[model samples]
Target: MPEAYATSAVASGATGFAPTGGVQPILSVKHIEKIYGTKDSVTHALAGVSFDVAPGEFVGIMGPSGSGKTTLLNCVATIDTVTSGHILIGGRDITNLRTRELARFRRDELGFIFQDSNLLDTLNGFENISLALSIKGAPANQIAAKVHAIAETLGVSDVLKKYPYQMSGGQKQRIAAARAMAAEPKLVLADEPTGALDSRSATVMLEAMEMMNVQFGATIMMVTHDSYAASFAKRILFIKDGTVFNEIRKGDTSRKDFFSRIMEVVSFLGGDASDAR
Candidate 1:
């Protein structure tokens, strides 16, 4: 595995974060195929899907229902096995990992944010974020510092003492974001992270995610159907019927322009225009 994919400290006081120039890809999916059911009734959820996510890049996967976006993410996350082909993360072929190694590999290399914040109601925001480090057996004395750094970066420092019930949806999601990044996993995978929030809350969550990618150099691959949420990503891959239909890069374009471009591709892929918002 390449050392570039190893977790590193966010350069303190850096304002604008850019992609890690010329680093090896943190994630590579090579000619992957996923199938379901028997010979008489087979479902091809993914077919020959391939892509590479460079170190520190924020990439989004978007597709309509049954378009195989979730299936692709599941395969990459190692939650579902690929019928064929390979998935390499940080130069390790995850598809070939043994069952026991799978659990350890996921814990040390992957971070996740789901549609729901998924915080334990019994734990306060601080403890909830700290749980990630604890599970990784980080030093007890250093856990607080790690948690505080991520919490501050995600703008949840003031609400760290509040429980999930006490905080608003946006605050809870920010706490979840803090937890995901606190572990400094090689890759962060998010599935519809803003799905449960209202427009205002979604904006706040997306902004925090952008900061995680840019300011902290977190390598993130997000699966979202909403073009608005996908706009925050530096690049997006549009999947349709289990194949890569289109891909776009933000480049030097403004986010608004990028969003418009995303919506155009979404519309081309048969997604409802209203869903783009």
Candidate 2:
């Protein structure tokens, strides 16, 4: 690990979007290594993966299946233990935290969105979102305000009262995004969030996500196999064989051009570029 990347304790009273003046990365993966199996047979799930996600940046991780992208995400999300390395979120070294502390840290610092909306069928969109804060014991009076605020930002305010089954896939995804952002987590981790949506719905969901990043200064790290979805990010890291093979920055580029660039890289990486559309 680089000396500059050493883990430090998070500052006290840090909220999810807590301002840091750009001094420290919101999420840091330093020389991470994850291997599966014993000495006799070892599977190198990750090989010296290192990266940083700065505040307010939307980072996309792209790789084909079995490329270890999901493994890396799991490691950062603390759902899987790293064989060797450090994962720092908000300056705290989560890799070393005890079980209870890990649970508490994940609940308080991390927000997650998956391919499935994961909204409770029995609950309305607002209730489904508020349930997260409620579980964290947020003040009852404040939960509604937070839910409404996030729902509005994610363009799901009108659908807040609707049940998941009653809403379209795009609406459900936007609601899920609202739930992820409402708590103001230090980082949002999304795994193929638009995988299940139709092309039109996926476009709407990506636009809403871009709004969340631009409007709320939300820091997001999403893992996707779709080129179109990845183009929405400001920067992208391409992983292959458990290591970063390449990276590209949107850097004032139009989404169409960026999509073209991403497709070129995907083709270079031997991945199917047909997914771009």
**Runs of candidate 2 exceeding 4 Å displacement:** 1-22, 274-277
What TM-score does model 1 achieve against the real structure? 0.90
lDDT tens per residue, model 1, 14-104? 1112234656789988889899999999998997888888988999998889989999999999999999999999999999999989999
Q: Which residue pairs overlap in candidate 1's backbone?
A: none
TM-score of each: 0.90, 0.90
lDDT for residue 234 in candidate 1, whole number 0-100: 94
For model 1, the superposed segments whose C-alpha errors exceed 4 Å read: 1-22, 273-277
Candidate 2 local lDDT, 135-211, one digit each (tens): 88899989998998888877788998899999999999999998888888999999999999999999999999999
Q: Which predicted model would earn the best TM-score?
A: 1
